[model samples]
Target: MRLAMLDLDSYLLRAFLTVAEIGTVNGAAVKLNRTQAAVSMQIRKLEELVGVTLFSRSSKGLELTSHGQIMLAYAREMVALSDEVGKRLTGKMIEDRIRLGVVEDFAAGHLIDILSAFRAQNPKVEIDIIVEPNRRLAKLFEDRKLDLVVCDITCLSRKPTLIWTEYLMWTVRSDFVADTEKPLPIIMFEEECPWTLPTIAALSQRNVKWKTACVASTLVAMATAVRVGIGIAPMMLTTKPEGCRTLDRSADLPGPVRIEIGLYAQPETAEGARYLVDFISRHTAILSS
Candidate 1:
């Protein structure tokens, strides 16, 4: 029996994923080093082959169709696997050492997966990855302890290479509900956490009384506190711990607020550091989804 040719072209998958990531065909074109018209044609060809409208265009740019969303996960996994195979076969992957820092916004398991993927492709690279709060990471980066960092910061002295805007919602224990008689119980980062004051201000603005249940040193400890009936705490959608969900925020609680994740790197950073920055940026686009 003869093997049938696959209808889904890898190039088209590349084009589709690029467009999905960048939110525009023209942007995808620039990223893929293809002309805008060529990128559009490939997208059309892909839709024809797949028999689904993959994107909806608008003034803001392109949004994925429902079908496109369904297709995206599979496309990304398949493309990632193919790329890994290519790297293994080429045996020419770069090798270097770098100190990288990431904010505690990532789910612990998800952060491992991200780093594992990078390590698998470039086995000889030495990575010293530190997971900490943005405040600490920013300070470390400034002190030259970190070569590259992906973190959320309220302000930066220099522009970031890329940024992702997100929102934080109040997350609470599975069975815990606010008691009006008592101040709301909560767990959060260290005192210097930029959100701590804003969280207080938001609740105070509405006369929602709250108290600091605990200021955990690590994200894990903070999450553990939230898991065990601690008061509501703000967390990014992607990083909420198990058995906890975003509160409805209808009961005088603060709603979600905008946050920014940024990639900062030294201009003279090692190749490994630069590659890790790009790697994190590409994978983090859909983090809050």
Candidate 2:
């Protein structure tokens, strides 16, 4: 018997990709401007057409199945190609400027590489990026000084266009030993930093005796303090400096906090900003990993 040819619709593929990226039908619905039931039905229809279960629920939320994982790459390519073709045909490719704000952690990690690739693809598009704490970035976004912003979810009142979770660990120099008997020396970010309050609250709740050894305004300064053995500092796993290591369970440190990173765009953002948003959304898996 001959195998049947698959007739995949671009709309269905887009819905599948959106649901997979967002991890919930409701979230995908909000992003796609569709109802929850509509998004759910679209996912079901796409699964039926593809003849496989695409998503499975776990403690975290909806996760892609093995088949869905394979489909993700193809779906993204197809959807992006479709959008590109549509834009080309409609003469929608416009050269514009984008003012973007990002948290310092991301600026130190993947933001440079991401921006390089975006610039390579869009040479005509000009980008101005400000690296600051999430709280400061949120303020700039609110003032309409930025066309796009990527920051911690806690800093924003609006829904994010893209979101991912990362953990903050208690990091210290490799050879440094914490004196549990004495008050722990902690290197903390200034009050404007989003993680500062949470880190302090976690230590206080755990009844851990800690004193601020250094208060730095930048992530680089905080890392330097940790490396020089000033004190332990909370840092994302990806941004932890080479000389520093995270305190494990044996260290009796407070549990790491899961922070949600959000990408947000203004309602009337320029074409360049929208293009950059799409580019970042496509690269979320790589960025998170």
Root-mean-square deviation of candidate 1: 6.8
Runs of candidate 2 with Cα error greater than 4 angstroms are 1-5, 11-75, 84-94, 204-206
- lDDT, candidates in the order shown: 0.76, 0.84
Model 2, span 212-254: residue lDDT tens: 8999888889888988889988888879999789997654567
Candidate 2 lDDT at 147 equals 94
Which candidate wins on TM-score? Answer: 2
| Total clashes in model 2, counting residue pairs 3 or more apart in sequence or in different chains | 0
* Cα-based lDDT at residue 127, candidate 2: 87
lDDT of each residue in 85-188, candidate 1, tens digit only: 78679975878998888877653544677788879867889988788777888889888998987777574565566566777788887788777788878676
